[model samples]
Target: MKIISWNVNGLRAAVRKGFLDYIESEDPDIIAVQEIKLQSGQIEIPLDDYECYWNYAERKGYSGTAIFTKHTPIRSFIGDFHPAADSEGRVLGLEFENVYLINVYTPNSKRTLERLSERLEWEDAFLHYVQQLNAIKPVIICGDLNVAHQPQDVKNDRSNIGNSGFTDEERSKMTRLLNSGFTDVLRHYYPERDDIFTWWSYMKTVRERNIGWRIDYFLISDSIVDQLEHFQVDDHIYGSDHCPMRMTINLH
Candidate 1:
């Protein structure tokens, strides 16, 4: 089975930029999106042969998430994080017969670190939620985690050391999560690959120069690591500053 995760920035803008064409080309079994920034009735993007689920933030034109799957899930969830409810529409949980697929848009600490504390709190709640779900079945967590876990995951790590997405605190939380039994699928295969990134800054020539960060990912329960076949970052396909990340797994 193939699964893809992307932060489209905005659904409307991405669609205008040929998002549908990209979708058709990739033909993933499931596609999860983050930062959709849209609500129902705001746009008409046809999703044929796919069951679409959306979680919209109360605030308009803000954070949101959606899942388009070729196969319908038996159950799903929007927000189950506590003490810091997923009011921004940051998470989507889809339960298939064999696994739990979670798509998330993690909170960013902001340029000033003003949201750092809250981001940490969110990490705790989100991790706990995943663990609880894992206890029931293996979980596939994907989307813009918003933190580059190591120097290898980002270009110019020295210059971005203390930045919101590269800070020690944020990276440490990611480490904790992985240590607790999730496999960072991409790294597991290409641990030493350099200059391979998923999200790029919108600044002029940044994407062209390939100055980017691998903030998006596909993580699965450690027990199912053997099922992971391949993982990739579709850097060449772009509708947003962030590109699509994909993974293939052998369900049988």
Candidate 2:
């Protein structure tokens, strides 16, 4: 099965730029998107084969997440794990026969680290939540986590150090998560490779120059690492500042 993740930045805007077309072409079994920036029922997506699940922030045109899946899950969750963290519409989960897919849009620490404390609190809550889920079954986590994780994960580590997404605290939280038994599928396959990234700044000439960070990811419980068949970054396909990343798994 092919599972993909992307941060559309804004669903309405991405749709105008051929979002549906791209979805139809990839035809992934399951796909999760972050930063949808729309309230529920504001727009309808015409995907007949897939069941749609959405979590919208109370504030309109703000942070949000959604999942589209060809297979119906036995159970789906919009909230209930953590109230305060869930208030932002940043997480949703679907329980399949053997796997639980948790889609998240992690809070970003502001440029000056204004929200760093809150961001860390969210991280702690999220890790605990996922661990609880993993205790039941392997979990597949994906979305715009908003941290570069390692120096190699972003371009210009020296120049970008201490920036919002590349800060030491944020990076350490990512390390703690990975250490807790999740495998970052891309780095698992391409440990030494560099220059490959998922998100780019919207500033002029930044993306053109390929200056980007691998903030979006597909992470799974370590038990399923052997089932991972293919992983890649689709840098060429673009409608938002971020690009889509995909992974295929051999379930048998």
In order, the Cα lDDT scores of the candidates are 0.90, 0.89
lDDT by residue (tens digit), candidate 2, 72-119: 999889755555447889898899998999898888898889998888
**Cα lDDT tens digits for candidate 1, 67-90:** 999988999888667533467888
Residue 68 error for model 1, in Å? 0.5
Clashing pairs in 1: none
In model 1, where is the ten-residue run with the lowest total lDDT?
Answer: 78-87
Question: Could you tell me how far off, in angstroms, the CA of residue 196 lies in candidate 1 after the best superposition?
Answer: 0.9
Identify the runs in model 1 with alpha carbons over 4 angstroms from their true place. 83-85
Model 2 clash pairs are: none
> Candidate 2's C-alpha lDDT?
0.89
